[model samples]
Target: MADVNPFYLGAFAVYLLIVLGIGVWGYTKTSDVMDFWAFGQEMGPWLATWSFVANFVSAVSVIGFIGAVYGEGYTLMTHTIFGLMLGTSGLYFAVDRVRNLDLLTFPDIIASVTGYEVARPIAGAVLLGNGWLYLVMQLVGASLLVTAITGVPYEYMVWVIGIVFIVYTVLGGLVSVAWTDFLQGTVMVGAVLLALGYMIFDFGGFTAINQQFAALDSAYVHPTGEGAYTAIGIIATIVAFFGTIFTEQNNIVRIAATRDVRTAKLHLAASGVILSIFYSALVILGGATTVALTTSGLAVDNVDSAFPVLITDYVPTGVGIIIILAVMSAILSTTDTRLHSTGITTARDIYSYFRPDSSDDSQLRVSRIATIAFGITATAAAVNPPGTIIELYNFRAVLLTSAFLIPVYLGLYWAGLSARAILASIVTGATLGVGTEIAGGLFGVPSTFIGVGAATLVLIVGHFLLSDTEPKGGTMAGD
Candidate 1:
């Protein structure tokens, strides 16, 4: 049997206790269906800021992103960061607009924007689909962290983590998720900074690490010069980042939870700045890992294992546990929100579609049931496991961004986009995106680009093709 570190286990237990305490408190505070799902639109800017940033830093970022940079080098960050900033700034513009609409669900916003009743259900289906895959990815990430830190069997860990996630989400809804996110987001940032500090101090210093990287290869410093990832790949990363930030329903719910339009905009700006700094720091840390690995003549079979190896090998057991906790935080931070979002989507989108007159109490009841059901299904899938965390996330990114990115953006900005055109755009883009992804990298372009291109083509052609008959009512017209 592998030895267990008492400090690690103790720390993990304390973290779980705190999270559960927060969930129980939030449950007590939740008075209505709106309060449960949207925090009653009373969230302060700081909490909203933390939750917004937390929404983006999933296990994929902690495990997959760090490893990618360690293996590939600078090009990963060059466009990826730019895309994140672009998306955040775009969302900043959307904050007031979204708040003003005061919709119950994200799909309702689409229906409002397009003046089409049909747009709601389409958006709902897409969000729920994305939520399922995303939940599975987070489950995989949590299981990986547990197995690495506790020497637990991966299959057992998935069910264990899955049940915990379901319980918290079904108990407290978005209110609990937001407060817990605030706590975890702070921990995640602190732990990452600590990890970087440890690496730098252990490896002599920044100067020493930089010299080691230079000694190894100059391509490590050049943005587009190293590894298998091409400029095209970078472009796809940007699109994924931009699309996810702009269109993801989880984020929309976060924004809706804020006090007002002004608070929402402030939170978005702050979250963007925070996200940029933290992610940039991660890039540097990844590069530092590359230097450390090369200088020590140590290597791991999988790049995703690089950070874990660095933590367990070099850092003290106490600090290493904190780092492990941070990874667990990263996994839970996103997983709970995704689970909650799925419940909301199922309740408001699917159940409401069938029974439009269902009471709020009834909706809440269905949401809890759906949340538990989705969590269990994702847990079952996690036992089998499919691929690396990043790969799974990237797969969903294309599928999600293609289906909703263009439609949402166009619905928000373009008055001429008809209900028919928006619907057609989502259908065609999603179809092409999934088909091309399965077809595998035809024409040297990523599936994301092809899918987005297909959507954009239909939007433009269909708009001009059907301009005279398009709907006249829009957000701008009423305003």
Candidate 2:
């Protein structure tokens, strides 16, 4: 902990107040379950685009993953390429179709396509699990930013951040989340761009960075640089992230919120371009951070401290506050979405499935309650975070993708997909995916690739081998 700048603290207080004000505004606009969950499907294309980009570049990307780029070297840039590819797929494949669907949540689509009553709850459970995991990771990163700037205890800051999120999200739901996301997204881009600009101006340019890295090792400059990542490793990383964009509940819900299919496409297209620039800047900033830290003779106890340490040591306090707010913006934007999505999964996907007779009004009430419950649980997990932010993010994304990836894509396009086949795929995929991840580097590929591969194989084999009935032609939207 260190002494805080009065101006920095005052600026952050104002930012939080503004965020709360937006939440209150959203509370006024939200009327029912549909409004609460999806903002009545009235989102503008640019708003949706910014929301998607903000969610995509969460606290993990702003802080922890940037640290990874610096510590791990240029080879890790493959993940950024994978993220860009994910955005492209969203534009061409996901946006048009998902927005047109009558379904409300990912589980609704799952059950509809598979024609299974059980699939809904299963999907809900996985959504809740992964959502909480991601929420916890963001909270950890947010608390780190808070502690660094305000000199607050990390444990205390975790609960404080959680409480503020719960208050706004519970009161306002998706409407609040979306509005806040738009503002946060704008701030996030500007903050990061400024940080990058400052780094280039203060530290030497790319040539100087390379010279600094040369003193360390030449591999830092190479694509397939020295580290744990290989060609297969890059593919595996790509596969995990690509699956996240397509199959994750939080992302899918954003697509469903778009005003129309055309708007969805436009939003996705715009998001892809924005993300490409954002991620490229992040990668370059990572390289610049390594150079800055080395030249300044700063001692980083943990690699995850790179971004925060760089700002504190090299940048002025006023500018540091803006950068920290940017980090907060990234964390809050993503965290609110996970919170809102978890509530929807619990109330709409799980509870409503079990109690089909429940009214939308009661469901809305339950959703608000669930939002608070999830916030508390995630805050507890953040108190003692298990890994670096990127590790948590990647593992949770892989877990959800393993369970849903094969079934979701195949269900969308392949008419013959069966409920039984989906069950087998999810179960088998989880087993192999977790097993591979547990087995570590000796397994030679990311757990996501292994798990997704297993799921796809089982699904295809079972569809051909097990079904004696004739081909059933139907789309996920219709089913």
Candidate 3:
């Protein structure tokens, strides 16, 4: 029996209309580079929260989270809770300082904190490297999702998502992504929760799902029954939350876009709590559904399809449309932000780094072009998609978190932290991060956790080793 109905098709049309309308409206207001890039730094708390939280919870959680719980179990959830707790709390100190700095990008913050000489090229490379790969991941996820849901050619979906992202980002910049996120994020959150409730009721009750989980159970109280609960596996669970809140350019940019420090603080604090609940609910729903399917003797290839497959195969017509909306909302919010962010990094961080005297307007134009080039590159990566969202995400998060997390953490608090320490923090963390990821496959060790541990070690040792040196410049973001 074919699962889809015309209702979804109609809903999709409505979604497209709303997206197009928002893009056009945002474009009309974009008059300069800052207007297109940072919403002219006029965002309030609510809008900033959406930009932060929605992008934080995207296709990766939609697919990878459930698959992780199903594979790793309660252990992963424990680690996730730890990481999120750290990230959400750490944001209080870190983000307020960032807000005070009057900077637009992470690169800007770094340059001010460490002196422009060391900060310029390294920050640019970090932002561009981080933004480009992350963009590719989201783009790939979008391509895979559209094709799976619609049975359309993956290329068509890629072009559609890429073009739409490039168009509005070039036109409206952060203003476009931020405003659009509020709408899409709301729809996505509501739809996901609604679907969870409906699915539980449809299955007869929690008892049914529990019985299935019991059968599949290992020692892990898995939020579903996955084996992800090992010592290091825990750290890997929600590393992205920590990684992005500090180092991710999009969040930094969004925070920078706020009108003042108070607004930035309000939005990020609110976003962290809201996003934590949202993420927990999503993983729970995924685990429960997988248990149900396994109980019924059905096998699913990728966890990304957990919600989508259930909607198409199990849910009623009306209910399914809601789920599709949720999925589309998540996809759109992430892609739009990524497209804009990658462009910002390329133009602001890399290209302009080489040419300091370039006009802002000229830089903005170059950013848009880079956006398109990166879009195509990302499309290629996502078309095939590397692995489940959680796994690929964990790999990226571990590497990124190790490399940047310490610098942000120390930079915000430890006032006497030397310039040499800051450099060591980045260098050591990055070196260990790569080594961990590469070693996992051959050595049969968990790379994600291994990398995090190694990075942590290097960060600590490197800092002490450089304790004697004077910071090359005055520290702090606004200095």
Candidate 4:
């Protein structure tokens, strides 16, 4: 069993109090729903970029990601690299486009560009489904870490984190979440760097870590190897990258929330560098765990759990306090923001389209309900904790690929991207994504690619067939 120390308890308590305090402070003066959802368009570069990267690299990477590499080797990192790069590039394409539209949600992006009333609601549903699935993954990931550090039951941690997040979110809205993320994100980044540094020295420095990696003949670290990467893994990564950036609401909402096209682009530039570094560290840390563990002969099956297990096993109680803080920071930073995203996505994009007369108060109420509902759903899914972190991570990428990839690009870039064309593309992609998942178990090849592959076809075919509208416009948000 895991022992919960006093220093760890005190550290987590202080972190929680500060977070709650900021949320309450922000809530006291929120002007409206826009303020609730987008911090009233008030985020600066530092706040916006930090919030983006923090939310981007959460519990999934910290716990789940490391676990994934431990099981699958460095090949997992390849998919992530491609997905990350493509995802960022995809965002860069849209930041300027969305910024100019000044949209509240991704649905706003769909409706503004597509000129279809129906696309707004459908897009919202697509976003909500994808966002909530990924959000639950984050929630479960956080809860597991909390339980390990605090000796609380996973379920209790889930509800505790869930309720606390809801309080500040419902109270301060985006104002509270963004400001709090900045503070929490800082803690998480600092702690991870510190932990990694300690790890480097503990192994007698980078020379030893590298020599161990090289001796092991781990092809996963060789970023240049192509064939060592499996066909399916690369496919999984490509589909995830193609679909997620455009489809997922969290990334898009951040983009849309920006003040202008230029701001959104800068946000992307900042996020690309920060997010890549953070994710790569997880891979390196995962590799290092083998050097430490294999020599010791511990029966470790899961890599994601490696970080937690390391703290308890090798690290002293005092130093473990920092790891505990990192875990808690990861849990709180990701979970609260996710609760905020799902509730808002469902309310603003999905619910409002169906219920235009819905008041801001009613919307706020619905947002809270959605948050609770998502938290409950995640708790249920987490009970099983199937496959690995990498498997779960791929789910979002899968959904994003089928539904959003081509439609997003065509919708944003090509003037011929009609609402009908986009809707068709979404249906086709979704069907293929579902098929890929089903086929993978039996045949060992993913069905998800069918949707993305066909959608790209649709993107090409749709352009010529949909031809020549006089100029609804060639508008974009910024650079």
Candidates in order have lDDT scores of 0.81, 0.80, 0.70, 0.70
**Where does model 1 exceed 4 Å of error?**
467-479
Model 1 C-alpha lDDT per residue in residues 1-479, reported as the tens digit of each score? 26666676677668778888888888888878898789998999999989877778987888778777776676667776677788888888777888888876778787776777667667888888789888888888777766666667889889988888788878888889999999899999888888888878888888787677767777867877565567787888789778878778888888788888889899988988898888877887888878777667778787777777766565689778878878878889899999999889888877877787899999999999999998999899888767777677778778878887887777788765676787788888888887787788668888999889999889878877776886566533221
After TM-score superposition, what is the CA distance of residue 462 in candidate 4 from its true location, in Å?
Answer: 5.7
Query: Which of candidates 2 and 3 reaches a greater TM-score?
Result: 2
True-structure RMSD, every candidate = 2.7, 2.4, 3.3, 3.8
**By summed lDDT, which 10 consecutive residues of candidate 3 come out lowest?**
470-479
List model 3 lDDT by residue over 1-479, tens digit each: 15335666667767877787888888888889998888888988888887777777676666556665655554555666557657767877767778888888777776666664446557667666666667666666666655666666777777777766767666677777888898888888888889788867866776665565666775436442354345544545467446655777887888888999899888878877887777767766765777766766665776555555666666677887887788778877887787788788878876677777889988988878887787777766766666656656666676667677767566656665656566666766666676767566325555544555665666567667776755555533322
Across residues 1-479, which tens digit of lDDT does each residue of candidate 2 receive?
45876776777778889989999999999989989999898889989989988877788888877788677777667664665466466546756666677577888787767776567778888788889999999999888877777777889989988998898999889999999999999999999998888777775676676677656667776777765566777777777777777777877788788888887888888888888898888778888888778778985877788887876677888678778878889999999999999999999888887788999999999999999999999999999998888778778767877888787777877776766687789878877876677676334567878888889899888877766653343323222
Q: What's the number of clashes in each of the models? A: 0, 0, 13, 10
TM-score versus the correct structure, for each prediction: 0.94, 0.94, 0.89, 0.90
By TM-score, the candidates rank as 2, 1, 4, 3
What overall lDDT, based on C-alpha atoms, would model 2 receive against the true structure?
0.80
Model 4 ranges with Cα > 4 A deviation = 220-228, 441-445, 458-479
Q: How well does candidate 3 match the true structure in TM-score terms?
A: 0.89
